[model samples]
Target: MVSSTISLAPFFSLSPSASQSQPPSPFAFRRGLFLVCHAFSQSESQADKPNSWRQLHWKEKRPRRKANAISDQEVVHQFDQLLAAKNLYQINQYLKDHAKTSNNSYPTVFSLFTRLTQAEGIGPDEYTYAILMDCCARMNQVNLMFGFLGRFLKEGHSANNAMIFSPILKGLCWEKRTGEAATIVLYKMAKLGCIPGIVSYNIIINGLCKNDEIDKAMDFVDVMMSKGHEPNVVTYNTLIDGLCKKGEIDKALDFVDVMISKGHGPNVVTYSTLIDGLCKEGEIDKAMDIVDVMISKGYDPDVITYSILINGLCKEGEIDKAMDIVDVMISRGHDPDVVTYSTLIDGLCKEGEIDKARNFVDVMISKGLEPDVVTYSTLIDGLCKKGEIDKAMDIVDVMISRGHDPDVVTYNTLIDGLCKKGETDKARDFVDVMISKGLEPNVVTYSTLIDGLCKKGETDNARDFVDVMISKGLEPNVVTYNILIDGLCKKGEIQKAIDIVDVMITKGHEPDVVTYSTLIDGLCKKGEIEKAMDFLDVMISKGLEPDVVTYNTLIDGLCKKGETDKARDFVDVMISKGLEPDVVTHNTLIDGLCKKGQTEQAFNFLDVMISKGCDPDVITYNTLITGLCKNGEIDKALDFVDVMISKGHEPNVVTYSTLIDGLCKKGEIKRALNFLDVMISKGHEPDVVTYGTLIDGLCEKGEITKAKELFYEMISKGVDPDAVI
Candidate 1:
């Protein structure tokens, strides 16, 4: 009896290209071959007599001319179909035969599985268990991947499965799951007797640094060095990039120096990362210095490097310097990219140079670079900033014409611009358009509209907008309340403003400085000075520092109350706290003192104001002179008048009136007449009060005839005298 076997190579001899390119009818040939093999196997029996018909049939079926030539393409195609339909059960069944009979080689099937896992929305299942673990590792699902690893081990799978551990660790590092990834990597490496490569260690260290676990990353570096694993340029660059991103630019530079000392040269990526960080931090000069360093080291700054610097300078309001950088880049044969152009346009627009920004857009188009949405948005914002609403709308129209549907930002910019120009109705219309386009109005949009309404003195409408905002699921921020408070205060609705403040606090929103100051100023302006003081006390108790405007309002209110002593004490308290009182604070106190007949005290404050490094303005001296004359300290008042003259402050009508009123009160009518002559000589016309005071003094001296003559003279001079005087 002869031993027999069957070959399936003849069926596979048909080329895949021929099968794919031709009709479906050729598939019948392959199906017929399978049927013939099945029939032959069914008819034959293993136990048979020598030279039996079954043995002859088996011998004829074995090998023939096409044995040992079967490819695994058909098996791979079936596996793909199963994987595509996510039929993991069928895949496991097929894999069982392929695993045992095919020398365990399934590269084609495994490759197909790898591609499927990489597809967006496709994921891994249990039958492709090893592949699923790899996918989990790639996606940084370390815990899930490790959990699967444990199940795989418990199911008595081979230890060669440990090969999946490194890739998993790498995935963890990439996903910034560093600490956990590192721990697992180290433990598994030890358990499997595997040593992590430099790339693996570098990845772990990079992740640690990114997480701001720099110390751990550095410790790992030290451990790697101790274990004789040399750190490469990539290792140093990773550390540098991480440090720069965390705003540790100086430390990053120091790392560069250390890298140089360790014979590892810094690469363009290292410099670019540092420059980008510096630019973002508003250290543009430092970033430029790094750019020079890169150039001197024979590294041409890339588009990103220049963009960073340009953006940094633009943000810092150094548009001219940013333009200079652009010129240098162009001069160095580097064509400005869209980002570079957008930065300049944004900076110019922000600086109120909309025309210049438009010119740049023309230049960008001439250079053959089509402006993107960012470019359009930047120009729109620029136009808005320059108050060029029509032009901005044109840009939006053009953007739409170019088939670039305006995003929420574009609408937001226009709405904000309209609101700023007090076009709340138009802004609201745009808001409706935004919602109609399926874009939800965010907090900024509502806040801008509310603020615009409040500015127009439409507090009720502003409050209504607030309700609309809340109904739309948007929470009002601190700014919303501040605007309402301001509006209510301006309308003399101080109590309502206070009620809003209470509501704000109840809603868990802490009252900011603006909140307290708005209410305080409103109270002070309404002559509710005591209530404002109570608010100040509450503000201080809440740990909020009163700003200079807060102090000024309080001092002005106290001055109005004729409480100069208390006002001065508040000024002293402000000074002791290192809060310098402004000229208004001094003027209020001096006017209060002069009104209270404390002319000498008022004069002293004038000098105190000068000594406190606040120059006495015309108001300061005028208030003091008026206070002194009202108190019958005419001589001292005259001296202040001279001081004001010497200080180049021209004496106006109030100055002459104070002098004339003071002299008349002292019975020095003739001298008052002399002062009036001098006043007119200096081209200072005597007002009605000046004439009235002198006329009243003449009447007191039995010169009624002279008083009547002066009264007629006052009418002739066009000075309307108050009837009481």
Candidate 2:
């Protein structure tokens, strides 16, 4: 029996070269069987001969019959080939067949899958079920992955291998299945004796935070501590980003403090996220404070952090502060990258400081920083705003020359600029150029051109652009309707503007404050005050709250129509709704009252304005003084001038002139002269109008000598007297 077994081993273990060339013949099988039977008979005949025959048969078969027993190296090679094809099904079949044939060794199967996973080309094998679970998690196929994992665990697979379960946990976390992932991780670690590492905890914490589960994420940190796994920098960063994204900037900062206290230093990403969140919330000063903290913590702010602060400052119209930050960044030995330069350029452009932005571009290039498409687009936008279409076009040429292809934004900037310059033909040509470059124009691009046409009073052409944009599969945003509404209103097409509003509603775009405000202002301008109010009613019916600007527009419109009582009612409605009337709102309301000869009520509104913490601007004083003087209330108007000066608000020429004119209109030549003296004493040189008003008043009062002296004084002060003199 021993000799027979040794002889049969040769049939299974043919030499590698011999087995590849040909299939086993029947003759070879029968010959091997005959040899085995002969050896066994011989072994039975003599006990000593049996041992000798067995040893001789084994020696003979050793080299020729060793193929059936796969080597560890061969198993790894086959497993890799299968995995490379992503042929998990075939790999499973191969493993099962090999395991049955190789005496069912679990170590061999485990080693095969593990080694294949480590190979460069081959991915993790199905035998390493954790990899599939991870893939499922990554693809958000949580249920399907868990089902497979359940089968794996039931089939005697060890769940204790962190190498196997950790990836699965990470997958679950990535899919935002944090609770399930946590439960699985805890179950594997406690029940199945698996212990998670730092990476495993990071995945869960990050997932929880991303899903806006902040409290849950913090609880997970506690769970990690309980499991004796301290959270790492990645873990803290994930939580910070999550909190920042949810606009919980204060909580994010607190997390940063906790991270530092725990000895995990925050990195650039952590700082950038916090800065961006603060900027979005308009807490720009607080954002800058964090930047200082970041610097003091020995963490240099990166390009992203700089971009956030610059954008925030720009949005607040604090261009100088934003530029200061940029200078500081350069002085700190940090070369401004493309985004940093782009942000600064964009901010400068938006502020109408085109020349300064252009000079910065030169400086950026000199410093070896190549201006990207965004940089060019920003410059183009600035130039367009300044009506420098020729310079903006030159920028486009330079962009093409520099091999930095202009995108939709670049085209939109140029087109918008040309539109603003009343060059609709040139703007249209740019749209064509954009299309020829294989770039489909977006709504912003089309909307820009439409707005340009509308501004030039070519509402029909603007409507054509809208149709073109729609035909090209671009849906018009809220701005598109606004431009058309404004255009139609300008052309006295109020009904058409209202129709466009209906279309906007039909298309699922609600009319925002700008939408209603533009239409209302237009209707007011066209003397369609009742229709404007009806539109306001419609806006409110749509659940859109009127902003302070909306109320101010209506008040100004009503005041212009001599309906001061109705305008005052609007103010009451605005304040009752807890909407603090802005400076513009107060000025409009006060101007209305003063115009209606209600000087006392108008001045009372000024007190209310001051009490509401709304500082009255120069316009406020000028409007009130003009109204009071027109109504023969010159003395009361003069009191407001003194109040304005005392409030630290510098009265400009308009404020002084309004009072001078009011005094003159009331035939109070001496008071007008006294006011002019007060104005000149306050370092405001009297203009021709100021002297003319006083001289004219003096002439009306027959004080010709005093009028002549005032005229001579005006001439001496280099104020050229016009024909009215």
Candidate 3:
């Protein structure tokens, strides 16, 4: 007799306060039972009220039963048939038995409850409420699910069965309320005399793993084992996956051993996950060993497994090994898919083997596997990076021909390539094309454009692009700011670059090590050594360690300012900071020492450099030779050239030019001409400096005809004479 338009809001309002900090106690759920039952009882009481218009209307609408009316058994049987068929609408109609429907009707379960109470043969039961609870859980309506649970408990159907609470545990976990799910498994179900089964524990553990609470998830495994519930393969696999994702591959492997010893043999998913973890850690060889072990265990690697191996090998630059794996995969009858081919192509491209990469694309099509968007994009990126911008565009055209639209990533790659080639204008034009194709330029797109402009010395344009990027709602990230700062610094606009850093900080962007290093380099270039040194101190204070480049820049600056001793001290400081001096560091220091006329001291540093296992490059030998030549040690300088050649360092044009200048300075005009001939014969073309030195030498030796002939020969060889000539 009650109106079917019953509201469950008042019952839900009786739920624990939303503002309650702690989780609701088991007593709170018990208290909720009374509140929900009270609501149901109130509705029934109003319908039963004597002299009530609702009761009168209900009496008039009552239909008389036939002689062959359906029995309670028959009704219950029909309800089960409908439930099995999942015919919710028919179930509602059969419960109501020709009752009037209303706009504000309650949900299907509540309507069934209301009608079954009024039905002739049967009423709502514990089994019926279980179905209702499941419905609420499936719909992700956890509050409604709890209300059904409260109703189930109130009706004295609180049996010691875990299935009844399964829906509750599942609903809580699905809503990311894993903590509540755990409470139900650990305490609430126990308090209700329901033993939590393996299913219940696994759901909670999987939920915890998903929440990244791996350690807490492991604790639950211990709790379940203590409670006499053996952890199954699903349980172990869940824990292993969590450990692998957290980069704890060793722990994941340990879990696998535990699983094996417990008679739950490691499955393909287990091996695949471990392999992926090892590959991510750059242990490609170990990952391959894992694959061999998987095969020994009678598990044939699937396409996904093989693909993972191929990807690992490719990442380690073992392209040939990756190809061999693909061959082995094919021999085992696992056809290489697009991902496998794409990964190989990417590896080849990274190694600068573009032609080989392109051949694989054809092979993929021959295998009847069409390349996806990712495959096309990766190939495009590789081509662009190789400075093959035209070829990359052709591939984009081919991609369109194949009915795949070039995505933002494809456009961004093209723009970056053009920018690196110093074609900023062409790169900017790609943005308009990208927008035309309905693909909005993301942060990478705008940042690449800004970088292009900055590198081209168009800092003002780059700044304007930053403003435009903000206007378009794309906030410049730290990389974008760094590019702009680097540009200004390179332009010798140190003050403007410093101001940009201030603005960057104001915008909540913290300057990283690169930012401080760039600032220091700029200060050093501007001869602001004290300020540069202060910036270095500030950098270290902020917990940003100066890299080798930073130390080398400062050293180079000090040496240029006639502070060779200070530069040498910085090398010691760099070593103390745990940064080993690279070749550039040695070269910078040697050049600094040589410029200060400390040729013998520079030789001492070279010995120290070799002792430290830092091999002297051609620049090192050239610096020492220049220092000796300036000290008028032509014989020693020439001997040093032999030492350079003997050490497997070929004498470059600079080497030949330096020797010629040394000989010319010593008034050995004939010897200088012979050195020039030796320079030419070694395929080292005489640059303007080389030609100019020989020409000056000839003119000074009173050989006017020979000097004019050499000058004309230099011009014929396309070596432009400088003002020094």
Candidate 4:
């Protein structure tokens, strides 16, 4: 016997010369040669003797042969006849097959099923309703699925089939109605004597994890175990991923141990998830250790694993280390994909290495990897940070030319750049462009604009943006509220700042540390130290720890009011809170003490500052010198200038002006004249103050000729003498 073969060319690909739109019809051969061959193949398999080529050719040539002759309409007519005879088993079987084989044409299958049930003398059985329910589930009409379930129960069908309830559980879980899914799995399924299998439980667990209901997901795992359904690797991975995402890496690691003990070893996905969590938590070293453990277990890290590690390194500002990993990835035959390159670009941009970041974009393009929206956004962010807004705009143009529409993040980056450069108008225009492009400005976009306006002292304009943002249904977050309060404070509108804080709380935006810090600083600047202190107590009561900026603000406020002792007491309080005083704190204190004629006390604090390893900056030394000169200690002030220079601090115009006035006030006329020559020789031009002090000294000495000559010299130097002269 010879086996006949059918050529698939005519049934599949079209000829090169065939009209592209006029290909062979699928139904043309589907109802003809395809069915004839199918019937012949079945008969040949069951035959006692193989059929000859002549017999096979006869079947192929006469595709309308009896067994394969029925048209689709005739088949439907026969199905209606079966339904009329109440042969429900056959009707249900046909419907079940149709539902399963419908692919995505679920609505059509459902319509056919509905018409069959509505036929005269036709009633759908339990299996028919189950098929209908499955159809509803597939169509995302899960609400209509319940109607089919009702029909199944009304027909007195057994509810013991777990498969029948699986679709319902899946639909509910997919809709994030995990509470209902759980109720069905725990109570309704039991009521129907249908115990859910692992697949059904896994679906609910996965959904719960995705919705950030990790605790509830874990409780279901316990229930699943109690019900004798052992959790699989997928079950454990879902829980681990949920825990990791919630920043519960320790708990996620514990789950990994539990998973291994239960004989389900962690796979690449499990390790990658763990590494990603650790990286996000800034535990890059620990993440690397996990990767090593993964490799020791014979599971080589894939591209995703490498990308996660690179991202972690980039986030930690270890850009060079991240690049080393990229090289290792390529050497190991895994290419650095767009995500890996984008992560590196973001890192470089953050480090202010904009040129290097652009070079990376070139490298990525050279490797035939198209820069994604994230990659382009990162480059734009880098340029914006470097104050190259025009170049950033050029990158946007290039991004558009490459068919990549700028996403919300891309627009937000551009807005942030423009606003920081004091181009608030341009930023606002971009907002319109974003809306025109069908992307609504998100919270970050509005927040950036609000912050820019506030920084430019346009508090009124900033307030308008806040109102617009709310009208757009985007509520002001804590950062937004903090920006508004800080702006109001700088404008001396403490009452308005407080009102904004009140509105923030009313809107359920609890004041974080930044909010309280900004308020404290504002109140301090307004000289309402007592109220600022009261806010401190409120902040502490609310469990928000005041940071260094808050304490520095309070200390500066007290020192300014000649309350140096109280400022000292606040320092002790700040230290007690475990926040060591920074340079700003010490400078504020020194400036306060010097202003109060407590030179010895100021010098004592200076020693303490040094002992605490807080090096004095130029302001620190200048404040001390100003105090000495005010106390008529000319020699001491002069000596301190030498010490300042010895400490590598270059005295600016203030330093020279202060010393010149000190010498002239002491009537050291020759010394004052010599210091002026030294000031000029040191490239410090004499300002009106410097010359006025010298000219006044000459007049007091009754040297009218020298005073006139000095005044003439001041005029020649173009130093505009003020009324004090």
Most lDDT-accurate candidate: 4
Q: Write the per-residue lDDT of candidate 1 for residues 1-725, one digit (tens) a residue.
A: 11133322222111222321212132443353344334333433221222221233223322222224346677667766776777556665665445433321333334454455555544444446655444444323344444444444444554443454655666666667676566644554555445666766787887788778887888999877876788899999888888887888889999998999989988888888889889878888788889989999999998878887888898899998898988898888889987788778878888888889889989988999877667787888878777789999999999889776766667878988898899899999999998788667777778788888888899999999999988987778898899899999998999889999998889889998889999989998898998999999999999999988889888888888887788989998898888999998888888888788887788788888889889988888888877777778788888878899899898887778778888888899998999889889989889877888899999999999989998999899998989866
After aligning candidate 1 to the native by TM-score, how far in Å is the CA of 454 from where it should be?
A: 1.4
Better of 1 and 3 by lDDT: 3
Q: Who wins the TM-score comparison? A: 3
Rank candidates by lDDT, best first: 4, 3, 1, 2
What ranking emerges by TM-score with the best candidate at the front?
3, 4, 2, 1
Structural similarity to truth (TM-score) of each candidate: 0.60, 0.66, 0.74, 0.68
Q: On residues 1-725, what C-alpha lDDT tens digit does candidate 2 reach at each position?
A: 12323423322211223332222354553354344335534443222211121132223311122236777788778877787787767876766555444222333554565455455654433355754444334333344344444445544666666666665666666656677677766654555666677777777787788788888988989988897888888888888888887888888899899999999888888888888888878999889888998889899987667877888898788888988888887787766776677677777777788888898899889989888666786787678778888888899899999987776667776777787778889889988898799766667778888888998888988888888888876789898999999999888888888899899999999889889988998899887899889989988998889898888888889989989888889889998988988888888878778777787888898889888888888888788878877887777777877887897778888888888888788777777778787887889887888878888889999988888888888888898989978
- Judged by whole-model lDDT over C-alpha atoms, candidate 2 comes out at 0.74
Candidate 4 local lDDT, residue 633: 97
lDDT of 1 at 179: 64
Query: Higher-TM-score candidate among 3 and 4?
Result: 3
Error of 2 at 205 (Å): 6.4
lDDT per residue (tens digit) for residues 569-652 in model 4: 999999999999999999999999999999999999999999999999999999999999989998999899999999999988
User: Which residue pairs does candidate 2 place in steric collision?
Assistant: 13-65
